[model samples]
Target: MLKKLEAQPHPDDANPLLRLTNLDVTFTTSTGTVTAVREANLTIYPGQTVAIVGESGSGKSTTAAAIIGLLPGTGKVTSGSIEFDGADITHLSPKEWVAIRGSGIGMVPQDPMTNLNPVWRIGTQVKEALKANNVVPKSEIGQRVADVLEEAGLPDAERRAKQYPHEFSGGMRQRALIGIGMAANPKLLIADEPTSALDVTVQRRILDHLQVLTEEKGTAVLFITHDLGLAAERAEQLVVMHRGRVVESGPALEILQHPQHPYTKRLVSAAPSLASQRIEVAHEKGIAVTDEELTGSGAGSVSTSEIIRVENLVKEFDVRGAKGEAKILRAVDDVSFGVRSGTTLALVGESGSGKSTVANMVLNLIDPTSGKVFFKGEDLSTLNSKDLFKMRRKLQVVFQNPYGSLDPMYSIFRVVEEPLRVHNIGSKKERVNKVVDLLDRVALPRSVMRRYPNELSGGQRQRVAIARALALDPEVVVLDEAVSALDVLVQNQILLLLNDLQADLGLTYLFITHDLAVVRLIADDVVVMEKGKIVEAAPSDQLFDDPQKEYTRELIDAVPGRKIQLAL
Candidate 1:
C-alpha cells in the first residue's frame, strides 16, 4: 500500500462507507505476544462486495470476528482505526459493541450451531436479535422478525419462527442467520464463509441474497471467505491475505484472472468449484472415465472377499413429529448403493436428503428399518458383538468437524493409537510406530504428537482426524464432508492424500460431501440425491457433461463461476 493509500474517493463516494487503517489484532499469551493481523488496511465503498480472502491462518475470519466484536476472549485489536459510516468505532467498549453490532453492523458466522441457540425457537431468536440493539420495539419485533425472515428468502416464515433450529434444515438455519443479521438493516454486513458448508443449490440462494442486498439496499458488505471463485463471481473488490499479511488487493476480476501472488494462484488452482457441464454431457454421449476410475490403481486394495454392500435399502426414523404420536419419517427409502474394493462412489445432496442416514446404515452405526446390509456378503445387521468388533477394524469414518470428533484430553499420538489399541492391531511400541506413519501419511508433523486438539489450528486438527481414521489401515473409509471445513489449498492436499492412500493401499472410499469440487476431483461415480432418492447416477465426467436429473442440472448451474467460462 502507498504511504497515503489510494485516497481517491469515487466522485459520488461522499457517503464513503467503512474503512480500516493500520489494523492489527494481537493476543497476550502465557508464552509471548502473538500478532494475528499485522498492519492490515482495507476499505469498502457504500454498495460494494469487498471480499477478504485467505487460508485458515490468513486472518480473514479473525478480521471479521474483530469487526463484529466476537473475537475470542483472549484477542483484541491492538492498533487500528475502524471508521463505520464516518464514525470511529474501534475504541468502543463491550456494551457499545453490543449496541453497534446488530444496529449498525451485522455478522453471519460460519457455523449455525455456534450462533444458533438450540433450545430456542427460530422466531424467538430473531426477535431477541431485533430487540438487542432496540432496533425494533418489543411489540413490533415479532412482525419484523417474520418480515425479515421472508426477506432472507425463507418460506413459511411464520411456521419456521415457531420451530426450533433442529426442526429447520442447514440451509434454513443460514437463512435464519441472515434474517437475524438484516433485522436491523445494518449498514455493513460481515459474513464469514456464509455458505461454506451449504450445498451448491443452497449456496446459490445465499449468494443471491447477499448480492441483491448490495444491489438494492446499498448494503456495503465486507464478505470474508476462502472461496475465491465465489469472491470473483460476486465481489466487486478482492483483498488477498497470507500468514496474517495482505499479499494482494485489487478488483475481483483482475485478481482472479491475473493473481500476482503465488499463494493466491495456488488457492485458485487447488480446487475448482466450477461444475464441468461438458464432462456430464460427454459421459451421456457414451464417454466413460468414471468406470475407469472405479477400477484403477486402488481397485484391488479393498478386500473383495467382502466389506459393505447395500441392496434395496430402506430406512425409516420414528420422529415424534407434529402428527401427535411417533411418526415414521422415510429417511432412506429403497436406496441401493455399494462400496466395492478400492473404488469411490460419492454421495452428494443438500442436507436432509438422507446422505448421513445412508452412511450410518453402511457403518451399522444405525440399523436400517427394513433393508439388509451385507458386509463381506454377509448380513451386517445380524452381526454379533464380537463380529461387529472385528468389522470395526475393516471400516472407519472421518467426520465433518475434526475438533469435535477428537478428544481434547488426548495427545495427537495417543489419539491415533486408540483405534489401533481398540483393534489390538499391534503391541504398544508397534502402535506408536503406526501412529507416526499415519501422521506422515496425513502430512501432519509427528512433533504434534505431544500436542492436544485445541493446540492445533482447524486444518491441523482435521489432519489429525484423517491420521486417526487411517490408524487401523481399514479397507473402507467413509468420509462425511471431511474436507468441507478446510480452506481450498488444504482441502486439495487432503484430497490428493486420499488419492495417494487409495493408490498405495487400495482402500475403498464412500465419499459423502456436498462440495462439487471434491466430487469432480476424486469421485469415480457420482450419486446425486434428492428427497431420499438417487436422482442422478453416472460417471463423474458423464454426469457433469450431461446431467439427466433436473436437480443435478440446477446444482451445476448454481456454481458461482460455472456459467462465466473462465480460462483454465
Candidate 2:
C-alpha cells in the first residue's frame, strides 16, 4: 500500500484556476465496486503547467475524465467539489458538459491509435472541431486546419490533410489529434500522453509549442503522462499518483531532486533519463548493476556465433499516380546490418521509416522485395513450408501495443499456454506447467493467471505477452517498441528482465524503437535509420558520446531532461 503525504494548507491569497477538494471517484462494475480516486485534492494556478504522473491504472486518467465529465461507464465523483474559475462544478448534466467541453476545456485524449475516426480525413476532423468550437470563421477553417497541422509538426500539411487516419502512421495520427485539441487554444487544456507516440525530436518541438502557449496565452495546461523525465522537464508543478491516490505533489525539480515519498524516489531512480548518470550512486549504495550487465552474451560468447544477418535489404511499393503512371516508393533502401548471437541490435528511426517493415522481413512475416535474410547461416527464402514452420520456433516477435496484441477473451494462463499447445510440445498438464514457469520468469504473480487482458494494466499485459514469447524458448526475439507504452519504472524493469533473459537463455534480440534514451540503456549496437536507409551504425557508447551524423545528433539532443542531472 502507498502511504499518503502529510496534509498541507492552501494559501488564501493564491487563487488557483482549477481546484479539486476531497474528490472521491468510484465505479460500479459487474463484479463489484472499485474506488478509482480517493479523496484526491489538486490545484493548478493560472497559466501554470502541471502534470499528473503515474503508472497505468493509477487513476491519473480517471481524475482527468472526472474534470471533463467524460468518465467511461458507471464512473462518478462520489464526494467533494471541483471548482473551476471560482465556479463549483462537481455535478453537471450532459447538456451542461457539452458547453464546457470544446470552447472552455479542450482535451487531448490518451490513445492516438483509436481516438480518431477511421472513415474521416484528417483535415475534415480538424475543421469539424474548429467549426464546433467556433475558433475561427467558417471561411477560414480550411486554412486554419492546415496551419494547425503544420504547427503540430506534420510535414506537408496540405497533402496530409486529405489522408485518412489509417493512411497515417501512429505518430502522425497522434499529431493530428494534437492539432485538433490545440485548435481552439482553450483556457484550460488537458493533454493526456500527448507525446507518447512521437519521436524524440518531434516530441521536443510539441512540448516547446505547449510552453509557448502557456507563456503567451495564459493557457493553464494539465499534462497527464507516465514519463518522469518529460514531466520533470515540461511542467513546473508535479503530482505523483500510485494505486489511485496522490502520493506526492510539489515543485517538479524539488520532487525529483529530493523525493519525500518512496514511490517518487523509485520513479527518479528507475527513470532511464536520470539513470544514465547514477552509475556511481548505484555503486556507493553497494548496488552491483553495471552497463556490462545490460549487454548480451558473455565476453567469450561474442566470438561464438552470428544468428541473424541481412544483406543489402531493399523493399519497394508500386503506387499508381493520378494519371495512372506507376511510381516506385522505396521503403527500405539497400539497408545492411547483422545481429550477432546473444546480443541486441536496435533499429532506431521515426515513424513510417520502415523500422516495422524491416522487423517483419526479419521475422519472415513478409518477404523483402530484394536482399536476403540468413538465420543461423540458412537463407530464409530457400526454406520450404515445413522448414519455415520449423524455423519459426527459432524466431518470435513482441509488439508495442499490449492491449492490441493480446486477445481480450482469453485468460492470461490460456494466452501463454496456447503457443505450447499449438507446437504440440507437451501434454495439457505439461503446457500448464510451462505457463506457470514462464509467468514466474517474467515476474508476474500466479494470481494473474485467471485474469483477462482487459482486466490488467498495460505493463501486466506486456508481461503476459513476454511470457508467451518465451514459451517456445526461441533463439531470437524481435521486440518492436515492447516497452514504449509503459511507465518509466516499468520500462526499466522490462529492460532489466530482457538483459537477464538473454544471459540465462542465450537469446539474440532485434529491438526496434524511437526512444534513444531507451536505446542507451539496453542496446549493445545501435543502427540509426532515416528515410529507410542506414545513416549511422556504432556501439551505443560511441554513438551517444560523439554521434557521426547530423540526424543522430539532433535525436540525442532532443531527449527530454538532457540538461538536468539527478542525484540522491
Give TM-scores for every candidate, taking all chains together and pairing residue i with residue i: 0.87, 0.88
Clashing residue pairs in candidate 2 (N, C-alpha, C atoms within 3 angstroms): none
lDDT per residue, candidate 1, 116-226, as tens digits? 999999999998887787876778877888898898888888888899998777888999998888778888888888888788888887878767754577677887888
Model 2: which ten-residue window has the lowest total lDDT? 1-10
Q: How many pairs of residues in model 2 come into backbone collision?
A: 0
Question: Candidate 2's C-alpha lDDT?
Answer: 0.83
Off by over 4 Å in 2: 1-14, 121-124, 134-164, 167-172, 277-304, 320-326, 409-411, 445-452
